[model samples]
Target: MTTSLKLKDLSKKEMLLAPGHRMCQGCGAAIVVKMVLLAIDKPVVACSPTGCLEVTTCISDYTAWKIPWIHSAFENAAATMAGVETMYRALKKRGKISQDISFVVFAGDGGTYDIGLQSLSGAMERGHDMLYICYDNGAYMNTGTQRSGATPFGASTTTSPAGSSVPGKMQHRKDITRIMAAHNIPYVAQASPSHHLDLMRKIQKAMSISGPKFINILSPCHRGWRSKSDDAIALSRLAVNTCYWPLFEMDNGKTQLTHTPKEKLPLKDFLRPQGRFAHLFRPENEWIIEQSQTQIDADWNAMIGAGAGASGVIEE
Candidate 1:
């Protein structure tokens, strides 16, 4: 039998996002943004770079945002947000904008892992008091599903289309969470819409912390992944279970695994459902599936070591 729960139980008692936004149906990014907003108890100052979320929320003059928001350039979201927060700090000292505001920056994989990597690294290194969220939909969905650095292996995007000679994206996703952790930021975590409570908890904790915090959210794009809108959350769950995306957190300078699936699913179970990787099952394309499974196994082992703190890493 199926059970039902109220939205209130699944989310916080706050409403920052209202109706009339243009996000695609079952867009994971929207749910992520809502969770972030709900976790913030103070006035919020959010900056979004050019991406799907930005375009959907801010059309000509119509804005779906209730918080103080800004739309910055496509590649400088972190730099711009850090500057805004620095100015806010300066302004507060001069009795300008109040000091009760929380700062947050929303970036897509194209903006964070590809174009904005340097800027993002700089902000985290400088220890800015802000939350930078990378809504990784695996490709540049807003720009027509082009491959970005964060695109997973074998996913067929516009730029990396499946064809006679070429398969899809050539590279595995960048290890963004580890890159953030390397900066020695106070907090860094991976989250997804499949685990609402865990996502909300991490956001609240990150907000309470006092340095730069990064949250990498697995945002499933229907158009990019070529999947039905309803499959977004299920795909997210499959990703975690298959070890394609492991949920974990780094606090101060230690790593800890947040969630481990009870029943590990096969890589094919995850790959077969998405049209982006449909070519992998085509007799000749089976090697891609084998490669994916091998990578998942290696990654799972790495995560186990990272979690056990056997490599001199402490548990966060």
Candidate 2:
């Protein structure tokens, strides 16, 4: 039987990620963790690399995780999880273990898009039975908010400050979702915390499938983004509404748009709330907004042309 996602039922599940951690107030990563752990029906062993989520949840002598969790380095989360899963399979083959367990690796943008990219690619290439989740908050928010590969174009970071010399990051954000899809993994998806049901459904779907499954979720960092802590959900939803982050999945090799904006909002609506892009509002930098929008339009249309919306929308 398929796992039911009714909110009432989900709320009854034991909280795998307990509260009282040191995650920045209103950090979306915490919400992502809760949603992911709640959706899984089987016992899961999760691996989190050294980042905000890891440091905050697995503090000295105090752990917020209820399940078996592993703490990996900033650059080896995927590799570590791969080894764990490999051993489980090896032991099960020898009839040393009987219970079915799920393996998951959760990392941030810095760990997934840049630092851990090599390990992540290797894990997927090897076809390990594990689920990798990237809660992309754009920059390296955990460590002084440095610029990361996943940081959006023209968004200021510590390394790419919006100053007279330069205006935020000059290059566009790297598309890690497509990179993972290129591996022909069993599942690859991009979701957001604002769509709780959609995110939970995707998690459950990934857990059901064997082999490496990747889900890239857009999370919000209040301190880094200079936005109101309470605006995290609205900011996340604006990303989807602006087409900055589409809710889609690549099942096998086919792409499907899970949720498309009913009426696409302007990119400014997404950027206006965040201080990272505050400079873009200046008269001199107005052209940057134009360029960003043009690029976004092209990418969205290309996805449609490439069959992203071929199967129809999943509806948020």
- lDDT per residue for candidate 2 within 1-316, as digits (tens), equals 5557888887777888887898989999999998898888888999999889999998899999999999989999999999999999999999999999999999999999999999999999999999999999999998889999999899999999999999889999999999999999999999999988889989998988999999999999989999998988999999999999988989998888888888999999999999999999999999999999999999899888887783455555
Cα RMSDs of all predictions?
Answer: 4.7, 1.1
Best TM-score goes to which candidate? Answer: 2
lDDT (Cα, 0-100) at 48 in candidate 1: 93
**Which pairs clash (backbone N, Cα, C closer than 3 Å) in model 2?**
none
Query: What is candidate 1's CA lDDT for residue 34?
Result: 85
Error of 2 at 278 (Å): 0.5
Candidate 2 local accuracy as lDDT? Answer: 0.92
lDDT of each: 0.84, 0.92
lDDT, candidate 1, equals: 0.84
Clashes of 2: 0
Q: Give the TM-score of candidate 1.
A: 0.92
